[model samples]
Target: MKKLLLGSVCGLGLAAGPALAADLGVPVRAAPVAVVVPGFSWTGFYVGANAGYGGGKFDYPFNAFQRQLQAEAPAIESRLDGRLGLTSGGFILGGQLGYLYQFDNRLVAGVEADFQWSGIEGRLSGTGTLTGTGTLPGTFSLDAGSQVRWFGTLRARLGYAWDRALLYATGGLAYGQVRSHADISAANGGTPIPGLTGGVATSHTRWGWTVGAGLEYALTQNWSFKTEYLYVDLGTSNVLSSAVDDPGNGFSAGASMKVTTRFHTVRAGINYRF
Candidate 1:
């Protein structure tokens, strides 16, 4: 009886030992994943292409005689107010590369240069009455036709950044190139007679300043999107009158155009943070 009891105890011990070993063989649990926070180390270089609409207002200050004649001229008689209004809507493309310095409180300051190939233009017409011993009073009408101007800006930015989004304002130097044209005519008994048709093309690069604000949001670790508005004053340029000599006028008028352009752009771009 003692031998039989010993064998049964040995069998129970073997079975219990296998069960304990199986529990010990289980794999260890994995640690939780680490969250990646965007850092202020976006101090690398980047390039991007953007297309958006651009528009601006322009003023052409007239001479004393021109202003007086314009005021007295009938609205239907023909005249282009020396002002070019709200003319905007063009495609803009450019690239940017800059260095960003981040402070302890997440404020970022940087310098950037941006350029654009633009197509923005406007047209205006004006008529002045010609007085002489004619049987009926006649009118001399001068019409400024469609003129195209292309411009670009280079700026520096300062802003506060929140992880994947940045709200900032920028101001810096601006530059551009433009072309102008005009058409002149005379009216007899309301019958239009075309006079001098001439134009001038000028390649101008001016040193000006710009101020704008923008919001840039990150779409991915390597890509960002932005919307911005910039106000620019490209200083002034002289645009000579086209029909100065058609009627042998001894003194031809020269118009000084003071150009101020404001651009609002919405763009999507990709940047590789280094």
Candidate 2:
């Protein structure tokens, strides 16, 4: 009986061994799955294409009569205003490249460069007759026009960003090339006024400054869309000067033109961030 009881007890303990081991085996658990999420940032480099409209003022001032020929000068000057107002406008298309950085406080800053093909142009003309100048009364006519062919900008941007959207103010160097044409005729009164007929067409590069503001929204991690407005001023320039001699009137005089080009542009663009 003692041997049998001892064997029986050993068998029971052996049978329960696996159950105890299962309950107390080193508790193993998958390391609490570590999860990490990312925040939105506007730090990146980008390239973009844009299309827009441009409009502005093209003013040409010529006062050849103001220069010489005293007798007929005042009479001719009085007959017509020596200004050609070529109100200007047209289409603008371009591409740009830029870099941007976002600060901890959501302040954003960047620099951008762009080149565009522009079709801004204007046309104007005026005609009148000169009388009582002591010479044969003369007929005067004037025509003028301007076209901005291409333009570029190197600008610095400052803005505040809200998650995926940015609001910015920009300003900097603006440059462009223009072609202008002007014609003047104070002819056909042999004794009245010295017959003078001349026209000038010229092309030159202009430099100026631009200031504006914009809003940009990110459409994805690597893409954005923006709308902006800029005011650009290329200052005033002289495009032509003229001189004529008339032994008939015993007077000689010259003509000149002064032009002022200033414009505003509104643009919409899509950008790819790198």
Query: Which 10 residues in a row give candidate 1 its minimum summed lDDT?
Result: 62-71
How accurate locally is residue 209 in candidate 1, as Cα lDDT from 0 to 100?
Answer: 72
Each model's lDDT: 0.58, 0.83
Using all chains and alpha carbons, the TM-scores for the candidates as numbered come to: 0.64, 0.81
lDDT of 1 by residue, 162-224 (tens): 887888989888877755554545555776433223344444556667788888776776667
**Residues 166-260, model 2: lDDT tens digits:** 99999999999988888877754543333346788988899999999999999999999999999988877887776656657555656678888
**Model 1, 102: alpha-carbon shift in Å?**
1.5
Give residue 235's lDDT in candidate 1 (0 to 100). Answer: 66
lDDT of 2: 0.83
RMSD of each: 8.3, 5.0
Q: How far is 64's C-alpha from truth in model 1 (Å)? A: 7.0
For all candidates, what are the clash counts?
7, 2
